[model samples]
Target: MLRSLSLLALIAASPVVAEGARELSAHEHGVGELNIAVAGSDLVIELHAPGADIVGFEHAAESDADKAAVEAALAVLGDLSSVIALPAAAECSVSAAEAELHIEGAHEDHDDHDEHEAHGHDDHHDDHKEHDDHKDHDDHAHEDHKDHDAHDHDEHDHAEEAGGHSEFEASYTLTCAAPDQIETLDFAYFGQFENARELHVQIASDAGAQAFDVERDAAALDVKGLF
Candidate 1:
């Protein structure tokens, strides 16, 4: 099995399609995928997985609670140096790092509904006022009810409105002083994401391409021939 893994890794290191530029998703929930490529002194890595795998849930973030989680995830993914350790001799620095998170239904009909509802609320603002001549009572209950209904609707929309799955993909690039000397790569992604148990990695470079698996407990991989 190790022999096959090495062979596949070598094969994957060769030039393929523009796929290396695109995000490649994983096949399962707890499993994630990482793709790394070396081009001269520049190294590009991409990680893709279900949103739940990275952030613990795939539903649209409606509450204030999810922002902290999102920021923490982005912080971890944004700093490649933190998640993956590199050789000091290589003198690698993350020139560019970014993360993209997508909720399956966040911007679809749900958004349209939100827009339509926004215009609706604007035109009906006066209807919410109820006046009693004797006591001059102002009833804002209808407006309050609409606000409550919208919240409920949003929660429901995120739950069942989307098709397929929600996933996040992050890309980070590194510039190395000695790119050739950087022969190995290590990841602490497992430590960052508690639910992610396994990682599938694809590697391609000037030398060749390879494919391999990295379990959480074993979080290191070789990139000897990457460039």
Candidate 2:
């Protein structure tokens, strides 16, 4: 298996891919990025796509339906043959495959946020406890509770409006018996993920580097002599 970082570093050396990397980094909906690197008899591919294009939603999987969609998408992504087909003469077989979904939100920082909230709650409780009269303390606490509830409701509304951003990433490493026999890479990714409409591909090989823009209508990357 090729080291992912090394493979990406070699691909990044391609001037076209390097220059366009910034534009490809944008999390544009319906657009996906693919990087291909061929070294000796090994071929490595990395795919990056917005969660919206993969699962129809870019938020955390909170509901059963959302979770199911994420699972299905991952399954499809993990299947290397479902995404790209190599020339049968090349005799390529996937040696490694990985796929994952990531949601951008407070989820990753939940522990820190929870700690802060707990500290603030303790402070508020102590302040209420210091009151001389028990009934006065109860009434004040009740009002404060209502205020907190209202604040939380406003936050929830804002979060809903902002929605959530997520993405899917997959990587594959394949070994080919006859790498030079590869004439093209037929992408079936667009058909598998209905929301994926465009694929920006970058290729790096001993022959040099090249780039191609593939649309759903034409999803083949010609690599007749690249290897």
Candidate 3:
């Protein structure tokens, strides 16, 4: 099956794709997005949101508490009933669902930190050996060495400040016995996550394509006639 991003590319070919892309890229803290497509009895929905909206922060889930929060959010996103409510009359069941926290630049930042530590350790060892060999010269360079260490510490702080922020992505596939019976999609997401204030929705189906800005106050999408 196509991944949600690939599916997004497919939707991008449609007329409303530009607006959808713009909304997602804006990355407003309390805003989220949903892309829905219906074809026959198959329904696909992709959800995207800033990490802050789901987990209270956008940094990588490094600490145990942060990691736990990410897992909890993923669990909720993966469960269809927890995040969405479809028409019961449609007799729909989930076929597949996936959720992930995408930490931008995390791997690159991790690799850089590892490499810096290794090089720093080796350099320190080399300096120690040189000091033993040339005690007099090393004593004279002690002040310069302190200055270099201070510079390195400042650079490390800057690197930490540039740590990556995260976002959540979820995709779901459902099969309905009666496609035409689907009239509305009620989102329980706002109740699950109080931080989520708005959902920018785009839908494509047999009837046509349409867009909506669903707010926390009105969390349901009127999907009548889409099938």
Best by lDDT: 2
lDDT of 1 by residue, 1-227 (tens): 99999989877865553334223233478888889898888889888877777888776555767756765676677677656778787888887776755444433344544443333332333333332123333345454446534654654465465443566667788888897777777777887888888888988887688899998888888877565
For residues 1-227, could you state the per-residue lDDT of candidate 3 as single tens digits?
A: 56998888777777765443222235678988889899999999989888889999886556889867876898798787777888789999998877765544332334444433333333443464566686554553454344435544544343345454467888889999997887888989999998999998999887788999999999998878877
Each model's TM-score, in the order given? 0.63, 0.64, 0.64
Stretches of candidate 2 exceeding 4 Å from the true structure: 1-25, 105-163
Whole-structure CA lDDT of model 2: 0.73
Q: Candidate 1, after superposition: displacement of residue 175 in Å?
A: 1.3
Which residue pairs does candidate 2 place in steric collision? none
Positional deviation of residue 70's Cα in model 2 after best superposition, in angstroms:
0.3
lDDT of 2 by residue, 1-227 (tens): 46998888787778866554322135789998899999999999999898888998886666889867876788788888888888899999998887765443322334433333333443443444555345445565655554544443444444354565667878899999999898988998988999999998999888788889999999897878787
Model 3 lDDT vs. the true structure? 0.72
- Write down the lDDT of every candidate, Cα atoms only: 0.67, 0.73, 0.72
lDDT of 1 at 214: 90
